[model samples]
Target: MAILRGNPGEIIKIWHGGIAIHGGLIGGFIAGVIVCKVKNLNPFQIGDIVAPSIILAQGIGRWGNFMNHEAHGGPVSRAFLEQLHLPNFIIENMYINGQYYHPTFLYESIWDVAGFIILVNIRKHLKLGETFFLYLTWYSIGRFFIEGLRTDSLMLTSNIRVAQLVSILLILISISLIVYRRIKYNPPLYSKVGALPWPTKKVK
Candidate 1:
């Protein structure tokens, strides 16, 4: 933070505020919802199309946290990492301040990348919003456990991680929405005529 650094002259310091993924997600979600409402579009449908991309982005983004040496987990031993059979580069990075830490960022990145692959392939077989909901469910499930390992996570209390809490809520909400939409609307398939399910259905 610029304020925290006492206004360091370096340009990087001017913008070196700490990471806030949830803030970005919330802001983007709100903005996307507003835009969808204005355009009379179904947000979930749009989300279905974009969900894989979002996860892929998130997967790549965690590497940034790695570069910053933040968002890592508790300390471990080099032998511990060797037991896990991690690559030399990863094993080396885990060593910080004479201690090896869990490569939580790598764990999450791998989870998200895998999710992206699964979601992209499965979208065609899924209902309109299920792709997005599935994305949320998958990501949140991984994030819930991964956040548990993170040492720098935001905390509601000494024992409660903010990301883990949010992840749990997201998983529940996403699954709920998927089940509700499936039963209530019987929505069109993502692989069908179009993502604009309501409009396209009436048009043709």
Candidate 2:
């Protein structure tokens, strides 16, 4: 409705199309909190377990943007894309309307995949509940720059990209929380309790 600059009746149009990942993340967090409360689960532990999987899902989800031909950056040369050494199929899809655009979707997906790898590798070494902060920090770092390259970003102001702004804020907050937790608890990366990736511990 806001993007369309439309009235109340036209607000329904949003149902037909648009969705924002930021909004989804916020909603998911709220839902997670509720579920964690009900289940008597430690939210931080759950967050650590879900961190890598979140990025993995994001990596897979970016393909949807590709299929829809949305979330792409502005025009670029085929030569530029080729120089990046992207796959042949991606090169072909980029060749739309006699021009190639920056494959922002692919860039984000690859970044997410890399983040997943980093998170999984370091997860066991992280303190009791730091993986979630790491996830936020890693994701926001890439998104801050990538959102700048995107032409289709939602705007909070004339010069401000909404996602970029959120990413920046998240990066600061995530890093701050990680520092605070580490100082307070000084936990080792290796966990004696909790399953790999799931954070479930065996009963004594």
| Stretches > 4 Å off in candidate 1 | 1-16, 195-204
Q: List the global CA lDDT of all models.
A: 0.82, 0.82
lDDT of 1 by residue, 112-191 (tens): 99999999888999988789888888998999998888787777777888788888888889889888877887887888
lDDT of 2 by residue, 68-109 (tens): 777889999989999999999998897777888999999999
Query: How well does candidate 1 score on lDDT at residue 86?
Result: 85
How many clashes (backbone atoms < 3 Å, residues ≥3 apart in a chain or on different chains) does model 2 have?
3
Q: Tell me how many clashing residue pairs each candidate has.
A: 0, 3
Those runs of model 2 whose alpha carbons end farther than 4 Å from true positions after fitting are: 1-14, 185-190, 195-204
Error of 1 at 10 (Å): 22
lDDT of 1 at 66: 79
| TM-score on alpha carbons, each prediction | 0.85, 0.86
Q: In terms of TM-score, how similar is model 2 to the real structure?
A: 0.86
Question: Model 2 lDDT vs. the true structure?
Answer: 0.82
